[model samples]
Target: MRIIQLFQVALVLMLLALSNEGRVNGERGDRQCEFNPSLSPRPHSVSILEFGAVGDGKTLNTIAFQNAIFYLKSFSDKGGAQLYVPPGTWLTESFNLTSHLTLFLEKGAVIIGSQ
Candidate 1:
């Protein structure tokens, strides 16, 4: 009975250690593979805003979109801020992305525009 209990405990510990190590490895891989704004055409160090988003499927966040563009323009001179769009279907007339900007499109992202 003592040997069986010790073996069970050892098995659980081994499983926990392996699980932790695997989780760490997965995180490192994701971080390493993600897009970094530093490598964009121009790097920036500025702040942006996301305003007036409808947060629905029908309406496009015009003010929010424009705000993002304008904010990017503000930091264009200094260069190092990334404009991030949250995961959703964004309907906009147009979007002017800057060289220093980084656009991260998650899987199944949908951006609609009619011009």
Candidate 2:
């Protein structure tokens, strides 16, 4: 009887797992500027700008970040490229927004603009 109960529980768990859905990064029920060249921004470049002075937020590699900004600015369209920062505490050191790009901050979002 115990063995049968355990088997039933395991079967239920398996079914639950099978029914669960999976989501991709920046591609769930989200709306934001996407990195598509056909779009306005034209995939000029990718930039990572942190918002907090000191925190565990992902840091944009100094040089690469600048280059990304420069690239984005240089070819900044009226509306095109997308800046995506996942949900969490993002400590930005500096943020330079370009034209035509939409900044998407997910829910439970914490964006600390440099004050």
Winning model by lDDT: 1
Q: All candidates' TM-scores?
A: 0.49, 0.38
Model 2 lDDT per residue over 1-115, tens place: 9999999999999987665545345345455546645534345334344422222456433343345455556555534555554566654546566666655555555765433
Residue 39 of candidate 1: its Cα lDDT?
51
Distance from true location, Cα of 103 in model 1, Å: 2.1
- Deviating ranges (above 4 Å) for candidate 1: 1-49
Over 1-76, each residue of candidate 1 has an lDDT whose tens digit, in order, gives 9999999999999998877773564564334356545655446432222466543457866667777767776665
lDDT of each: 0.62, 0.53
Best by TM-score: 1
Question: Candidate 1 — worst ten consecutive residues by lDDT sum?
Answer: 41-50
Angstrom error at residue 42, model 2: 8.2
CA error at residue 28 for candidate 2, angstroms: 31
